[model samples]
Target: MGRYKSFLRQRYRAILGYTGLICLISGLVIISPLLALLAYPEELPLAWGFLVPGAILGLVGLGLWQLLAPKKATSLTLQEGSVIVVLAWLVAILVGTVPFMTIQGLNFTQAMFESTSGWTTTGLSVVDVTKASRLILLYRSIIELFGGAGLAIITLSAIAGPVGSGLTSAEGRSEQLAPNVRRSAKLVLAIYTGYNIVGTIALKLAGMGWFDAVNHAFAALSTGGFSTHPESIGYWDNAVLEIVTIVLMFAGGLNFVTAYLLLKGNFKSVVRNGEIRFQALMVPLCSLVILFGVAIGLYPQLGKAIRVSIFETVTCFSTTGFATVGYTEWSSIGWLMLILMMLVGGGAGSTSGGIKQLRVYILYRSLRWEIRRMLMPTRSVTEPSIWQGERRHFLQDDQIRQIGIFVFLYLILFCIGSAIVAAHGYSLQESLFEYASTMGTVGVSVGVTSADAAPTLLWTQILGMFLGRLEFFTVFVGLVRLLRDTRPILT
Candidate 1:
């Protein structure tokens, strides 16, 4: 009982500290956006509201700080670590919503959905952002910025260290780059921030206005894809801007760890990386196929078609839904490819979301291995494989099963979401696209999602954003762990 009390106390204190820090940071984010809003017409005083909330939150955090402070844990369990992760994000979403709610007069539910979408880097927007105040616009970008930085991750780095030797072991990350998670978190954050800065500059130089540059940078680096203009990057009509976004989004979709390694001049390591190789092979091949489909079938002009093809491919792979053209209007084959891209997603540990290329690579590789084993049972003791090198670790039955389970659950959720939207009398295509957008956390749509959308469908979009952002499993495991913790233990 005493030990349990200690663990509870320690975790409670950590949550408070992290929450406070996020609130403090969120306050600063609110201010920046407010300053930006001053340049706009509304002249809404959104910053004042954030002031009170920020102050109250900081004080509460300060109070929480002194009460449940920690020295060390007797031990850390997977349950405890995961509990921390889940609670951390929940608090982040709640706190992050304040700016949105205060500015938009949104109900609690709508506010939460908007905030979660931004913080998750899902890029879905509920309110009409074009006429909205600068503060709100800036607030949206800040949400993407911090979210891409990983709210829990940033907070955790400030409040705790490696969590202990066991924390790293449980999380399935190697300490190959850093001695502790604090270092790793900082490294990733630095790279994330740097990427945004560089992307912003690149976009500005590519003829985007400073305002568009910053917001797009926030979206791109986060792989969130929220745009200041309604038409997104397409609003610019500049090929140079597309090139800039493609580079940033592609880089953003890659594993941050590998990006870190590359930063340290570990070029050879990235070259040999399993995920990198698969992503490298997939992008160009997908682009070529998409280009072929567009040129021969979809468009009358070749140059125009190729531009559309490359843009869609980049948008799909980067999981950045900044569209230059509506592929949804193209042939059935083209839309099908976009659908596949949303499902496949970007790389693991990237700002982007999806099943992640690594899992897909692993699943198919394992499939090939099993097939080869069956065909040559008498010829060898082992199975033939589709992948070699670092990803060999993914060949295990458990890994394959895990990947299959996630992919299946993701699809199931997508279907459930579609059905929910369909229940609202939306067309099948609209329903499916809504589901895809929600699951991929990609914001593109066939125009079904809106304030006018049936409330039931709205609710589905809300939950879809939640499921998509957490990508299902985190919520699943967290809920199961909570259930187990609350249940009576049998002797």
Candidate 2:
């Protein structure tokens, strides 16, 4: 066991060591958004205080990285590779919490929850937007930006992987977007930033103030739902702003690989990707259902109805929890549909969360195959399919088992979290919604998950935040590693 620990340490030191360095990078990024706002007339005591201390930590991290990190580079193995991904994400979220604590006046717990929620593209928050500092508001969006682009993917992409090594994901966080991970990261980051700037400027032109516009721009591009005001997009109360958010939110939910391909004039990539088609087709479909509900029952004004419907539709499909208005007030069918959409989420390789369209497509294909196999096992060699090209491939039996296991785990975790909330004296409906918000990373709740709640219950929220950000697997593995590390080696 000691031999294995030494082997693990030396074999993947580069990937292993960079976790701290990336946290420093993330810390600096967290502080970067605040510099401009510090120039504002408002005496942002919390913002400046948070910035100085966090910046120092980042510098300390950078200095330590320079001194203690590997002099020579090495690629991580599959096991080490998975560990690196887990550790890097954990550290990124840790550094991301600084602004929430120092600037936003959230204690470590709420700060961690909000930061984890943002970076996971899960829109949960405990901060009251009406009273937040402008700089802290931007910090929320920046976290979404980091989460939207996959900080781990960005880091992986920035560094050169070893010879003959490739980053591959058969399921969660799958395949590289470019020939090399670093180059792919560069391409995605460029596109991500471009979209954010465009979204911000368009909102500004549509009459939004600089602070709110830029913040929403970050949120929309990351598909994160944090806003400068509690009512979210509703706070703007502008038709043009809603239109801009709808467009940008959808853009953020798309696969960056296809985004890059479209930019390069390879329109075929969009045509060929199954999940992209599902997203394109489903967005309008969900909108129509929401439109029908809002137009016929929810509202009397046609324009307002359509606008709200579009906003909510885009929000749910993008896995963003921002509400132009209260969705819980809608019809039962409408509420259920939105809930279903929240669980399904947007495209893969995009900022959105939930089960994702790609998995849904695969699950559907596998289900159809199962029926066909049962009906004509002796005659039919292969099942009929509709998704484009290679993506049309159905889940194999092993893959199906894996998916089943993950789904079970996801549901169980949600149930346990909900139970914990209920034990804390929240009502059943609120408990369920809180758990769903955490697991979905959607951040919408019945006002149950908050800081004023009991401190004894902090661990429940923490679990939700960790699992929400890592999307279950990493948090589980990291916990296991923690336990394993503490136990003496049996040998």
All candidates: CA RMSD (Å): 3.5, 3.2
TM-score for all predictions? 0.88, 0.88
Candidate 1 segments exceeding 4 Å error: 1-32, 35-44, 72-76, 165-176, 295-299, 383-394, 483-491
| Candidate 1 per-residue C-alpha lDDT over 1-491 given as tens digits, one digit per residue, 9 for 90 to 100 | 66775655555465445445555555455455656654774565566766666566556655555554454432345555455456556666777677667777776767777877887788777778777766677678777887776654565456553555323322323332465666776777788878988999999999998888998899988888888887888888787888889899888887777887787886777787767888788777877788886645767777767777887887777777788876556666666777788878887777777777877887767777788878885868774243332233435677678779988988898888888888888777777766787778777776776645555666677777767766566666666865665533221
- 5-93 per-residue lDDT for model 2 (tens digits): 76555544455455556667677776777576556746455556657756876776677566655765455444444555576676767
In model 1, the clashing pairs are: 37-134
Residue 20 lDDT in model 2?
51
CA shift of 214, model 1, Å:
0.6
| lDDT to native, each model | 0.70, 0.70
